[model samples]
Target: MVDVEFRVVSDRRDGLLLALGQTVIAAGFTLLRQRMVNSEEGVVLTMVVRGPENGLLLLEERLGTHHLVNSFEASPVDASVANAVSAPAAAAPAPAPAARSNGGAPKPASDDAATAMDTRRVEALLPQLARDYPNIFIQLLALEHDLPPAQREATLRYVGQRVGTWVYKRDFSLGGHLALADAVRHIALPAMRQLVQAELQDDTLRIKNSPFCHRGEHGSSCHFLRGMLGGLLGGPHGTEGLRVVESHCRNTGAEACCFEFHA
Candidate 1:
């Protein structure tokens, strides 16, 4: 068993960085302990993780890929914890089709396909594309010029909702009968696989970790997700009035990215 430890101290608090830390845990590493010690210099975070031989490589890759921190140093630690790294990944439950809560639309064909697109692949390529060609998001943002500030935000949110609807319709071929809560908790997150881990309680859906928009560090991003949630609950045949509001964002310095859905 190999234990690798690394620490990061940012001059300012960054939720994206914290989210990356949580990502290490979500990625199936065994977290031994963590703490934030205050000092005259700044905020210091010391985290210890236990894993197999590739632990350091994985950590470095994750941190470097996301550009979360400027620098980090890792060293081997005594393996005191037993079998922590070998723990199996948690399996997400399948989302069952049900009657639409709002009775909005008709049902569609919902079945498992022999060939399914690998979401992890898509997730990886997207960020790389964004990094390689920053103009992608720039072009998306350029559309905001046509509308006023509030209207621009609202429009983008609506666009995101439509994108969610498209995913449910074309990508998943899901029926309108899926319950919003179940859709988010099961279908959406599971389909996303390692991209994110979340908890949905009532109308609030909290993301513990996500690689999207560089974990929301993209700043003024995830408009599509905001819209996606809206469409997921209220699209087409669904009558449930749903709104998604991200309360905490890694881009803005919160440990987790939270999306609150309310009628």
Candidate 2:
């Protein structure tokens, strides 16, 4: 195994860390330490990772091609420093306290705050999801089982938004601005078909055999699809403030999952 230090610069910081981290893992490396800072150039990310010596080339290729990365440099770490950092720690650290406000008071948490999606975990599995396509119900089943019942719907929705935004930025952002119906037909429908069987009819989109709720046993499991639609259709470059509603779901004994769009 070899240890390497990487410095990456990006135009934005919104999901820079998560995106780069996903690329690193996909290229077969384990992240050891990381730091981020904003500079005149942009968002700078410095990370140390360990992986097979032969993996460097593949890692470089992945980093260079990543959509979120503007430029990056990677170099082998000095043996002594790598060993020192890799050594077992003397003791475990104490748990971190809640963050404080500028006034030094603990801030109360808001239930309305959107649940944080585990982008690293979700992105890592995205390739597998795409590769397997419509036959990916086993993976969706695992995700359904893993999440807590109370937060499952919200988490799936958030994941959908993340995935949808990612797809839009990666695929459709370069084109001219389109109207809602055009965007839905040209952008959203194609994107949706990548994961499920979907067809847009008028203002309604019907999804046949959605992997998330195909079994007809779970109670309305189309939260992710609904959230994805919101992300795809409501972005600034697309149509803003568009709403997606799940009118019918196979999980509720409907033949297909139906979504209605409203501006």
Best by TM-score: 2
| Candidate 1: tens digits of C-alpha lDDT, residues 1-263 | 57777776555554533465555654546454445565565666666766567565766687555544555667776664433432322331212232343654222212221022222322332332233221123223333332344444444554444444644554456554666666666555543332346666565666755444443224544564565566555645443666567877766667777787555
Candidate 1: global Cα-lDDT? 0.49
Give all candidates' CA lDDT scores.
0.49, 0.69
TM-score of model 1 vs. true structure: 0.38
Model 2, span 1-263: residue lDDT tens = 99999999999886566567656665767765567899999999997887888989999999998888899998889867876664434442211212457876322222332344444455444554444343334444555555567766766765566556666776788888888888889988998987777998787899986766643346777887887787777756666677788999988889899998888
Per-candidate alpha-carbon RMSD to the true structure? 14.8, 13.9
Where does candidate 1 stray beyond 4 Å?
A: 1-151, 174-176, 191-203, 208-221
Model 1 residue 258 distance off true place after TM-score fit, in angstroms: 0.8
